[model samples]
Target chain A: MRKLKAVKITQAIVELVKRANFSLRKDVLFALRKAYGFEKNRRAKTILKAILDNAAYAQKENLAICQDTGMPVVFVQLGQDLKISGNLKAAINSGIESGYKKYSLRNSICKDPLLRGKSGFSPCIIHMDIVSGNKITLTLLPKGFGCENKSQLKMFKPTSSLEEIKSFIIDAVKSAGADACPPYVIGVGIGGSADYASLLAKKALLKKIKLQRGLSPKGTVPGLERELLFEINNLNIGPLGLGGRATALAVNIQTYPTHIAGLPVAVNISCHALRSAEIVL
Target chain B: MKRIYTPLDLNKIKSLKAGQEVFLSGTIYTARDQAHKRLVQAIKSRQTLPFELRDAVIYYCGPTQTPQGKVIGSCGPTTSSRMDAFSGFILAQGLRGMIGKGSRGLGVKEAIKKYKGIYFITYAGCGALLSKYVKSVKKVAYGDLGPEAILKLEVENFPLIVAIDVNGGSVYG
Candidate 1:
């Protein structure tokens, strides 16, 4: 029997939540820089420059990059062999509460979808999975509502081909317009049930734009993400959709073997302020 | 591109156009979905608001709490469309400028044209960076909405993009 290793995910969770609210990830900054380099529209390029500069200033100042720090969301893939030293729920909640309170991060959560505390960062949503491994991997995401409001998922006919999936993602981004904030990361979950697929799609948001190039499995941009990038950017929404290139920095696709006759696809939209952090314990 | 802090009185607001950047100095009010609803209700009943709306600019913001000795935390613009329903009503009460991100639906566009009001948008999610421009905070209202409540803010050299102009020029272009 592979005995469990006593690991505490709380400390890491606390850091992850606060740090995520504090600033954006390094790879996210790199993606923004790259977009700034390649942006075509003169106005869009200028806008991208200011945004890139702001990201750096936000970090050095130890301030949140965006005002809406977003709600605390986590996806935990616990290794079966990993054991908990402390109370997991307390650890998670404490970390989140402290992060928001200490950092002065906005608490955008509410008990009722329509009403909640003035603290923008109330109510947290967490999902856990026990995978086959010795080390636990926890991905924390502080998802902003601007993009969350634009996310969509639906079940398509099993006969839908790759072209159909690509079209759906393009249309989704186009429809969202400038609301979700352009130069975003588009995560598409395909091949899961309607419900499971939405969660899976969000899980895929963990993949940063620069990191998508060399994923462990097959490596390099897959058929899905490559087409998604070309198609969505072609919409000419550009940075902030002010009419120039650099609409989406990247599109990431995650799939699972699903039952026959059911093809579900969900698109999780992430704004340019991709404020998220993670920890491994 | 221009960053300056000046009083947001009627004369200053009257000369401003839509899509023109103005770094508001002096005291400006903040409100969003909840407060807008209340403001509209008060107007409907011929009741005065907590503050006057004539020639005033109401930022559609719900800011985070400030740490000790600070005026505010990361504060940024929100989806302006959500507050569109109350804009026309508020504009009628002499409201001049509304600031938020994202495109306003047709209703808001028409309202802006009719009322000679302009819409401005600051950089979204750059709340922390933007807060530095805030010189001081006078008061907070509707605390129940958390970040969504109202703030009486005084900013210096704040940056924003003129999203919509008094002449009907829109930033959505």
Candidate 2:
């Protein structure tokens, strides 16, 4: 078994928090630029330009990309063969707290949901998977609530048609409109139970936004993502819902096996500033 | 782009139309979810507000902590829709204008039309870029709320696009 110190994990998480907040991912940037080129409306084009410029400025100045540094969500792929010497959860939380303090990042986590009080930095949400390798991989996604609040979950009957599912996805983006910010990245999770479906939807956002020109895998409905993308853009929500062709930068779907009785679907939308960073140790 | 200043003139605001880009200068107050609640409470209770309400432009924002040698941190507009429930009351208090991103509710639109108020939208999620416009910031009230505290900001050439006009016309349409 490979031995790793818990403090080292803490150190890595601190760095990850800073990187995720300050830098917009390159693939997302590429998608935005591509959308900008394809956009015809003058207002939409200008909004896209401002978004791109903001990303650049954030990276150069080492500033949080948005005032909403967002809720810290850490995804850990822990190696089954690795042995840890210190408390894992504490290390991660302390790392986040220290990083936010040191970098002057916004403390967005409330102590309680309903009885909300002063916000502090700590107790980051973590999802872990024990994998085969000896190295641990940590990915941090600071999800902004503007977009997160617009997330949707529907338990469709197993007999539902493909068009019905597609409509639900499209309507999710349409209803989100300009409130969640636009040119969103739509992530769809098409299976599993209720909570798991939502988790899958959020996890799907970690995937890179790339331009692909073909069908999805064999079992799933082919061209579902492409068709949904087309329908969503046609809604004309545009960059900031002002008007244009690039309402969604991409639509990513992840599927899982489930019981025969039901079909669960979840949609997680990310604003133009979709930010995440990952590190392996 | 049209240039406007704080303590906005009603005539100037009336002349503006939805979707018209403008550069705003002068003083504004930053207030988000909690601060708005407190302001509305103060109005109902007949208590004095931290700043005068007449002709003031309130920005829907909760800025990040100020870094060393910086007037403000990443300061950007938040979603306007969240404040819709309190807007009619706030507008009724002789407020002139608001700066935020996204659309407003129908009641808020009706209030804007009735009260002759203006709604402006800056770049959404462009906090770093938007902070460049802020010349200075001072915490005026609600120190306990941290980022949700009310802040007085002096801004220069703050870029904005009129989203809702005094006529109830909306760029969102």
Q: Which lDDT values do the candidates have, in the order given?
A: 0.76, 0.90
**Tens-place lDDT digits, model 2, residues B28-128:** 99999989999999999999999999999999999988888777889888888999999999999999999998889999999999999999998999999
Candidate 1 structure quality by residue, lDDT tens digits, A72-183: 7887788888666666666677767777777777766776765543444555777888898777777789888889888999888888866776778888998889877778
Candidate 2 — which residues are off by over 4 angstroms?
A214-222
lDDT score, candidate 2, position A64? 86
Point to the candidate with the largest TM-score: 2
Q: Best candidate per DockQ, number?
A: 2
Give, for candidate 1 chain B, the lowest lDDT window spanning 10 residues: B2-11
In candidate 1, clashing pairs total: 12
lDDT of 2 by residue, A68-153 (tens): 98889999999999998899989889899998888888877889989778988868999989999799999999998899989999
